[model samples]
Target: MESYASSSARPDRAEPCPRSAVSHGVGLAGLAGLALWTVLAWRYGMDGPHAGIFASVVACGVPMLLWSLLVDRVHRRPSTGIDWSGPRRSAREGFDISVVKLAGLWATWGAIALFYGTARWYWDGGYSYAMQLFGWAVVPLLLASIPYVIWLDRYLIEPRDGAYAFGQWVIGGAAGKPPEGAIGDHLRAWGVKAFFLAFMLSITPANFANVIGWRTGDPLAGPVELANFLITILFMIDVSFATIGYMLTCKPLDAHIRSANPHMAGWIAALICYPPFVLMGNGGPLDYHRGTAEWDMWFAGNAAMLWIWGGLLVLLTAVYAWATVAFGLRFSNLTHRGIITHGPYRWTRHPAYLSKNLFWWLSVMPFLSTTGNWVDVVRNCTLLGITSAIYYWRARTEEQHLSEDPDYRAYHAWMERRGVVTRALAALTRWSGRGSPAAHPERG
Candidate 1:
């Protein structure tokens, strides 16, 4: 081992990165688990069968849980609402809390099930897979909730949360009703999970299958093929991490939803980007891909241009996926589990949104129509612009929600002052002798 004369003598430690809520260690733990699983799949000639695809949840979740609990000691955080030092709730009180929580939770699950059963789209295409997964999971989840809720309520700082309030309303009527907005809050939080979780699950199997069965043809035969394949891998990583996040939103992991977005605008902004409601989908109002050809097609026969363009597309996707990875097990939409200030987040508040929008613009090149019709070109470009505007709307509403948290506000300030993109733009403005307009703060 080598010794340093002083702290200043060590270049490696010269500048410490800004602290992030989710530690690099925890993210690495999840990545390591995922990497190991990938290695095993490749070694064993796996094709991402149903079992193998579902196993990804375990592959990513277990290691993250272990690291967060054993190493980071995340359970000790005040945000978790757990008080290990204090005596637990009384058996009777705990039972009461658990009972109400169970009532609320089971009712919520039932409602979600009813909604799924009635929704024609949920029964169609990829969503059918999510419905199947949820069907397979229901019994296990119902059986586990009883003991889990009881055990958790014993240590929660205050267990009479929205769920408990809803439960009270369900059983005790108006005489023992909770606050005015408690049930609404409970619904919004669960709604976020229910809507997004199903979508994540729906995409996960296909991505996993694509990645594990990535041996089709020579991927490197062309830049576009390689890029598509690589994008599949990045998407797999994003889906795997996001699936773990939605499933592991537990108090024990200190990743429970502290608050869901309260604004209808915020919910609307996010929900429209997802399935069954997405306006940007094929033939929807914002279907920009209608007249656009693939990026590879535009640069066909030009190996150099295709390679460069494909590489940029891949980079944008990597950033988008990195934004998810940075969340560790806290990557839910419309909820503030915690504020993260590292990884791609350090560069921008909404790296995923930014990069995804950029990817759509570059990859689709909406202005370039397959039919070479200026009319189609204008329509596609305009629609894609509106789609991007929706994302911007989402970012703003999310910022409005998270701005209430001091931690998020601090991160927002740091990004405004020291973010890589901010600094670069500042330099460019100065070089061009132009005054830079003030940019609004954002949240990750």
Candidate 2:
């Protein structure tokens, strides 16, 4: 709802700007400058808010400088043996950019513009209402989101490899050495798909849901419910963080990991995790359009199922966290890391995959309220099921990769021996307790 129109008084033209220019200009400005831009915008009386436009341009530039400084510092003391002089390297010798990199940069800005523009036009009624509604409620929520958005932008944008492909900082030396060409290739494929799908998917359900919820006349569901809804709306945060966490911990320990396989697994993982939310976002509105009363009933059922299944996913989170912490403490490097037999591994060979299935399973249940509506129901169920299958197959592929590694073979033998000894001892103890205490030399 914030006026995106740059005032004619501003010197800059409105033609599609490059990503670097926009990101640097906007980022340097920060939120405070953006606020000033708004005030200046008002002062110009909506005719030509040059002040606002200039302020915005100035603020965005700051981040570019900051980003450059960080990259220079990091690469200045490089240990990876990667030449800062690599052909793709920037003048600062900090980060490298590729055609895909440029594409990512431009695509992000374009997407943001498209989003705000579409929201301004299509969801006009709800946008105005929500602004007023939030005047009392959303202001504080928006204020809180300031830090969160800053964090998201910093991680998602500023760093080389940024959030899309890889993180810039190695952090406790915990990051795995991504397979050769993996970072660039991964970013190219993942970035394109994520950009397009997220833009198309985020607006429709989000606006529709907000509009419908506001229309419900339920005072109790005001800002609090809306806040909760907003968090879920950004479910990508959870999915993305979860993926990053998995990589930090699980990837290195995955003795089966091969350079090629991880990329494929990454794709499979994204397929399983991201697409459902998109389907859900767009589909939620369609279901609601059937009728408000029916929608509410269905929404409750769907929300319940989602919540229930989400609760189950807590188990996966724990596993990912444990692996991350363990790897961080024990071994500095993550790659060719030996397979772990403790924690969740002790229970099942593939706890992560099991967790992956649980994640999707929860996603499917929430829509059961609309089970009668075959399109929405079938569409989600089928994708959910298919993606889960893909994740399972990816897991098998990773296991195969491990099978060839010598370190992995050693760990496998150790685990097998440990398991046999422990199980036999337990059986002997049970037998002795029932009758006589017998020492079994064979078991020893």
Candidate 3:
């Protein structure tokens, strides 16, 4: 939320963003659904199988979808590009269009399948789990796409979106040409979905299993253990919502991607943070955990310090998860589905990144080596610094992408004027007699 300074105190305060497309209420609905599901699963010890974990997603998604449709009326939004009042085209006339659309859609899936097959990483490590998921989903998806395309085609104002355009190109004809760069845009969007969805699915099972399987006589016995347990639950929430996001990018719920990030830097910066490409993985270049112990280790005998530090870390982790919760079902990297200004987003634009980096620093003190080696300290700290720099780059590129949208520009302007971090930075900038930084921005 922007500052609430009255006119008497402040002369120039900008207006808030025009709309927060994702409602705070909708996120609460999802949270409610997930909480109910968590209770039942915990009671039954339904934590052994990945399938039950997948079902937890349904707990959240079903309610969110119902709330979005019945309460928020999201499907009626003009942004959805659906015109419910339009007269239907004759079945014969619409049949060809639907066929072409399905063709394009299937072709896109085929290309993704080929890529999955060719990519050695997909068959190995965590990605192998994602492949297993794809195996189960492909058939149902193929069958479902047929009716989905035909039904949606009837309402779309211009149904010949990226899939239709790409399909035309694949089929080869003059009709396939959809202005310039349309096909490129289509491919870029799919590329984003393919890459990130796998990563999300790949980790969901493991993380969900960990959270549900966490059994202890009293996990709350110690402050540090209680904090850890709570943080794990938060991460579980983040994972479930994020997976729901990648899965629900469709118009019916008004959560379709308006555009994927067109910038290469955005893609590279995001991809490097996950899976086989992750630079911070074990033995990777940015592995900063080489000679460090948990932050609590330093305060082992000091109960007060341990509790204080643990509470701080848990708070940061909650902030990180709250950022994901704000996204509801539209969260994804390298894509702009819509502008969101609720939940943790009210304080700063990048709550997840800020809180996440803070948690890492406080939790690992990676610079303080257990071996008392200066080289380890410098290497670890420098590497972690670079990791943060990459997040900064990722943030700038996201802002650059979202800048194309006037609403986001308005939101950015509002943040510059009233956001806690942005306003503070501006004051510091003016105090130092240098203007606020450009292309470099901060969020909660």
Candidate 4:
């Protein structure tokens, strides 16, 4: 008999089937439940503080249970190449495979569901009790499908000749020989993980406190207060996702550490915008509060204007969150975990960075400073400009690294030719006698 992994001999190789109707139904049900929960919460208020937490569990658990039942049924059947039934089969042989696959699926899904559900609860200001419940119930169930997904890939979906075991990948095991890398590469990975871990810790709880304030009827009497609230929530989600993606996942999801920013300039430019460093040296001007009073004064007594500005701020923050969500479990800074082309990425190459900078420009009103001094105004604007420029540089460096992969190269070309922002940028550069922006090697 031909090996399962061999593509040359067998014409009709076994493959894992596509998601079942039951799975689709479960997903739809989850969405509908979320919508209903949102409407009800908005109308009558939540079931109390822990309502979202409860909803999150159900949302994640039910779908998982349903999907597992399906997988168990399918696996029990005697499929052509993946038959578990045999005249000489021993009870231990069946037990090992079944237990390992199920256990792996449960563990992975449980972690994902809990983290995301908690994040959602905080984001909704604990008022979206029903939505939180949906998150709790649905996310885990969705994630629980992974182990069976691997099983299908190995036994039914792909040619299994050299396939790695489903159990191995679940526990962060690699299939082949360990990748060779210099000590610096390992150090960089550790550093990157540590930085994001600290970033999350610093922001998550602080933002959650802000959410609680919002929920408890704290006075958001002005546009600045509302904008700050929304901004804090957005950063909380971003930092949480980044922290989990970098620190919690199995080895397979980890970005292959090709290289770190060897240039001192890169480190200085990026780190200065974050904590500790942001508190030191010329970084004071980069602080978001440097112009907040001016912004508040400009919108004073103009409720309509405040509302419009606040709405724009929220929209920009939503875009940033959309990009983060698109990354799922792969989000992190200064690292490549394959080029994502979905969500906000479909419209622009740097949606998160663009949205974030725009938000700061509006919220900070860098053109106006508290001191009313020309020098302070100039310094604030310049610092913000430099921050924006730094992010642009980060985007360029990321593209340069990702271009080494074929998928990223194709994505780059497609974005250059068709993406709204890149296309407009190329045209502007051409109009300015700079030639096409795509002419730059890194642009591709």
Candidate 5:
């Protein structure tokens, strides 16, 4: 099945409005305030003994509320006309400069704050029951800000030229209208969403249960516990973002899914890695720590070394989450809202997959198991290897599907030539070849 690009002609495009700057500024200020609050809370340790709730409100809730109000007011004004000539601007020129700068700034600061806050929470002996309850209660409220922010971008902050930044990543510059797919494509979209929904539901209880376990003073010791806690939190964040991105915001305006992967092999490989289907596989869910007897054996006994490993795991997890953050309201497995070329994508074509696979290898320790038998090690390694291969296939299939679009093709070419991974590999090959017989043909 071939995926087509959107039409070049869009009569509905809107003109640039000076009022958009006001909305953009207000939205940006709110993001800045939230980021600052998070940083301050982490740095100063939330003031008093009972200050967590207040801190959360100040850090996340208040600014978002203000931003929402300002955005609503901005949208109440008369609508602007479409700017047909706006498409002539370069990709960089097309984006609202204020939005782009603010989104990047806020995303960077927010990620740093979240990482520091989460690490501090775990390292300082976890949270009390009241504190945990307060924290969890505040999560949904904080997440509520996402749709509002997206709404502001859609209706107020973004230019009528269809140019806007989604949390540090800019999309839309001479990009055509999204293609209307066949009934089969629509069914595929529904099917993909259904699978993600099921996946999210299946993992929800386990993540929350972990939180409860931490609150109840479960026997979580050293880095393993820390790693597990961080993973759970990151997973929860992903689930929330992915669920909202897939279910709520997927529409013709900003969230329109351009295409779904029609390859059966891609679906089978990707789907089998999650949920009840994962149970069908012997290795179980591509997560090395789960469904294995040797989970604890991977951690070092030394606290310092364990902490280092735990920190590394958290970093990897953060990178994985950063990819999702870059996607913003467009994240999903089978659909392509747009091609992201910033954030973690700036470094690797598949940052999430690469980091996730590395994380599994580190945390799962496939080389070591309970039994001394090499067979067990081999089996475990094979399972993980297959899972990794599946992701590789998924990436390739996605690339094939996306390559049909000119924007994606341009992005792919740029990444191939200038991306970090590509450059690093080229350097490595050059270094290795320098010492080889092939480099010294006369001596040979």
Candidate 6:
């Protein structure tokens, strides 16, 4: 084993990069080049046959050819400046503006291209009917995105630029200084928050459009449309509650919750749930046919399941509302309250996370029993699982930050002692074992 000192002395050389690094670098370079050329061709109005040939060459071959010759230039630099472990807050004033400006442009053109391509095919033959409907459902999202982009650019970005002067002019005390916490350095958090808020808001219009299109038989199917509709509604409710909680606990949105990083959790949750909407809207793997528009046996059963499960999600949202309001009432100071193992926390350290999973799971009930639809169910469930995993990690990181607090340690210990989850698991295991014995009898 290498000594710590030896390892420290030549960190880069201690464990040299894998032999396949060159191949991996080449692959990435090729991909980026392909993407760039594809964008260029689309911009230049490429047509069929010749356009297809030229696009393939530019998008696939050109990047590879260039990368093969100038690998050093292609793979010269690694990304830097992101301090994942750094302080959570900063004083930067207008950082959000630049981010919104750039991401807005990218999202705008990308959305246009996506919609145009999908629409052309959809109108051509309905061969990809499911995909076209999904795309149409996303139209409202595009509509809402415009205001959101402007909002971020105005409220977030502009302020960060001349915020220092503005702050000094507005306040007699600490006028010129950046607002507390590590000034300027943590503005990236604000940028992240602005991006997510805009993104989430953008979805609402699309969801509305989807419901309308489905009702009118314009493409988006009934089952797929219903699934996305409920999920989007739940998400909107969640954000509304969170915002209320924030306002109730913190000051005006402008005052507290200004730093981006700490507020990023909500945005992260949005990102976690976004893609599943598209996947579920695409009608799963097997082209599910509910037969006719009339209510059938399967339809009735699934509809009942949807109501029951969706009701449970409504209950969960209520739980979120209560918990969020309670959090504000308890920790209005914006500081972490140790382990926070109270109320819903007592049942599970993160009830909000579990509730989020519940909502998505409920949304998948319509397709749960169908064979191919299982793919949609699994895809949605996986998204929830991954999101929960991310929250678990964030919870640990938070615990580390607040570990010095005696109350937190006590709460942690109490939660551990409860062992509610372990008991539940044990019961499940016993039940499973008993069922197997009954089914198989004594094999010997």
- Evaluated with TM-score, which candidate comes out highest? 3
TM-score of each candidate? 0.90, 0.32, 0.93, 0.58, 0.56, 0.37
Best-first order by TM-score: 3, 1, 4, 5, 6, 2
Q: Which pairs of residues have clashing backbones in candidate 3?
A: 1-346, 348-444
Candidate 5, run of 10 with poorest lDDT: 1-10
How far out, in Å, is residue 167 in model 2? 23
Model 4, 1-444: lDDT tens per residue?
Answer: 000001111112243221211223333333344345434543555544443322322432233334424543423432223433332334454344445454444554455446545653334532243334445656665566554444433333222211123333444433332224433343454455545544554344444344444653443666667776777656645544444455432222222333454444555556766655663234375554554364457787898897788889889998887666555444666655545665556566677877888987887787876777777788778877877776777666656656666766665555544444444555677789856466343411
Writing each residue's lDDT as its tens digit, candidate 1 over 182-208 gives 899899888888888888877777777
In angstroms, what RMSD does candidate 4 have relative to the true structure? Answer: 12.4
TM match of model 4 to true structure: 0.58
- Deviating ranges (above 4 Å) for candidate 4: 1-182, 216-229, 252-268, 279-294, 436-444
What local distance difference test score does each model get?
A: 0.80, 0.35, 0.79, 0.50, 0.50, 0.38
User: RMSD to the native, candidate 1?
Assistant: 5.7
TM-score of 3: 0.93
Candidate 6 ranges with C-alpha deviation above 4 Å? 1-181, 184-237, 245-310, 329-342, 366-407, 422-444
**How many clashes show up per model?**
0, 14, 2, 22, 4, 14
Sequence-dependent TM-score of model 2: 0.32
Output the better candidate (1/4) by lDDT. 1
Superposed by TM-score, candidate 5 places the C-alpha of residue 16 at a distance from the truth, in angstroms, of: 24
Better of 5 and 6 by lDDT: 5
Residue 270 in model 5: lDDT? 72
Pairwise TM-score winner, candidates 1 and 2: 1
Of the candidates numbered 3 and 5, which has the greater lDDT value? 3
